[model samples]
Target: MYPQVLFQNRKPDRIATLEEYRKSGGYEAITESLKNRSHKDIQEILLESDLLGRGGAAFPAGRKIMTVSDDAPYPRYVICNADEMEPGTFKDRVLIHADPHMLIEGMLIAGYAARAEKGIIFIRPEYENAARILEREIGLAEEAGFLGENILGSDYSFSIDVHRSGGRYICGEVTAQLNALEGKRPNPKQPPPYPTEKGLWGKPTVTQNVETLCCMPHILRNGAQWFKDLALTEAGAGTKIYCVSGKVNRPGCYELPMGVKLSEIIEEHAGGMKNGAEFKACLPGGASTRFLSREHYHIPMDFNSLREAGHRLGTAAIMVFDEDTCMVAATLNLLEFFARESCGWCTPCREGVPYLKDLMWRIEHGQGEEKFLSMLRKQSKYLWISYCAFAPGAMSPVEGLLNDFEDEVMAHIRQKRCPFKGGE
Candidate 1:
């Protein structure tokens, strides 16, 4: 059975109010923490829980908090990374839209643990509705003494501010986010000085994903053991918001245990493939992840498990494709997105992606031979060794397609046309 932590009192079409949320025992954990637990105690609880970052890196969240707590003198800042810019990842937007108060409570608890005096929700510009809801909800929270000065009548005071990004994919990176918050272009910088030591105007800061922060209230209320038990596998813990897209009959978000089977999610949760289309393959995570064919659907969806299966559970955005889909065309489409979004910070990503896209175009159009395939394969190696995550991530779909759908690619070469030319 799916846990109620993620969708407890969910009204799919409407957002929950503070009053409604409080009635469902929403802020009780935070209220208890403010009244009873000290900053050190909260930090200890987090460490004991072993909660990893819900964002891409999967670093231990508790250790990060402790680093900020120990390094910063007195007032640190906590930033909730709400910039859900990854193309197929929209679970964060849904969570924030559904329950704004949950996020506020979680942020408050996190701020207390990190000894932070201020918090910021760095949201994407595309999430206009989410930002509006957060702003209004935050105002309500302040009036209710949950935010702003002297929160909950405790000596620990904290404030939260909502800021919108100028619209860029790299802005999702921590360093780029810090730069954007400081009124600069969103570009990543070299790091020996991590965010914990020097961040946000040279003050210590801790950044967490929107989903990561929202999980805090439940963690505090239910205890770390309960949270750990939520995992379907040893490597992962708690419920995850799985966003299903592409050719599924019902392409939407479903909250399930961390290691739920991909087949179960596709057939049961996503309502199976559309038009009774035969399942071909899936990008188990977002576009950045490697593709997994129908044979791999039995594998569990978790951080390390997915990696062991030769893919990354990146943002848990499962994009399914049916037999009718053209593998080469699909690979080209994803490469186009990566090429366009490249920040040009590194030479490989800036040039390699576009070049790879051109190679795919030539091959897809059947204007090439074995030489083109060889060149693309060699270019992928260079991309993998690039400066940042973008170049390597950008190569995933192409490499996966080449490895898993070599026959389809060869058909394009032989026929000089896309196999599914008329949408199969």
Candidate 2:
């Protein structure tokens, strides 16, 4: 309803065909960009747009593109990171199903902006159907000359392929994804040779999230100023693909202004809390981010605004919970997933996550020691020095429990039972 550029052609019950997308001026940007704009012009326009990466980190998309030097080696790669493994995150799957060509067109333009020749959509194994749709649509795109070998009669040529991952949460990490793509054991490689400098078989590769890449085509289609004006806040640009779930009546994807308030996203768009349930808290961004208590109910849901409030809009996967939900048990549940999915590559993440999970489990089951609280706090900070961000992210809910929901946690320890569970 709010100017759905991305979902403009989203058809209910079935994916939009190439004809529908084309009719709505889908591939028009790539065509116009290739014919008139130089690669530098593309770079400048993105910078002006102030588009940040939708993938957790919120890195500047323009700056990331600029990293690939114009003089960088040929046959560079631009990987569309479709490994949407974060708990409570599934916007990528919805976006892919709604319109596959949008992704293809976005990647074609991304490949051009990043000076890349090959584009790869590195998706997780669970998304097999989406992968097949992408493959089918890609074949259609090539047949229509939107991809492969002098696209649209321009000198630039690019090809895109969908690569199914072995299906691990670790594979979503940038360096680990590159390793997985190369058939190597997926381990987080410390940077020095950043992906843009050297990646994916020792070549300059630009890897971006599916949502991040999908933004490019639209940004290019609309002028930079127009893109900047789309956000509800001065700090944000364009619309955000929010994947809202849990406790909300309408738990699905919504394309809204980047800086829409968290309250409005819930009360207005998502049909408010389920069954008139009183809102207790929410993981404002997927499971990895800290919980947003009722104190910040009206907080602006944008990267900069969230950061200013000591929070993050990581993937904007808002997982809401009603007052009847138990915070301690909720945090414990998230911790278990993080511990189980840990790659076990580094000591902090390998051992630390499970160790923290055990402490939370004991507390929830009436075996908690007050000492464990201090230990949890200590370990959460200690894990930050891990090989990658996996440990810190995994420990976020733990940190949130200790910080925001300490009273609930203490209630469990003192009562020797989960407060939310049925009384004996």
Q: Write the per-residue lDDT of candidate 2 for residues 1-424, one digit (tens) a residue.
A: 6889788888789999999999988999999999999888888888899989888999988888899987888779999999999999999999999999998988888888887999999999999999999999999999999999999988889999899999999999999999999999998899998999999898999888888888888889888899989999999999998889999999999999999999999999999999999998999889899999999999989999999988889999999998889888888889889988888888888898899999988999999989989999888888998889888888778877788889988999999998888321
> Judged by TM-score, which candidate is best?
2
Question: Model 1: per-residue lDDT, tens digit, 138-175?
Answer: 99998998988787888888899999998888888899
lDDT of 2 at 212: 85
Q: Give the residue spans of candidate 2 off by over 4 A.
A: 422-424
Predicted structure 2: lDDT: 0.90
Q: Candidate 2: lDDT of 232?
A: 92
Per-model TM-score, in order, reads: 0.96, 0.98
Global lDDT scores for all candidate models: 0.86, 0.90
The number of the candidate with the highest lDDT is 2
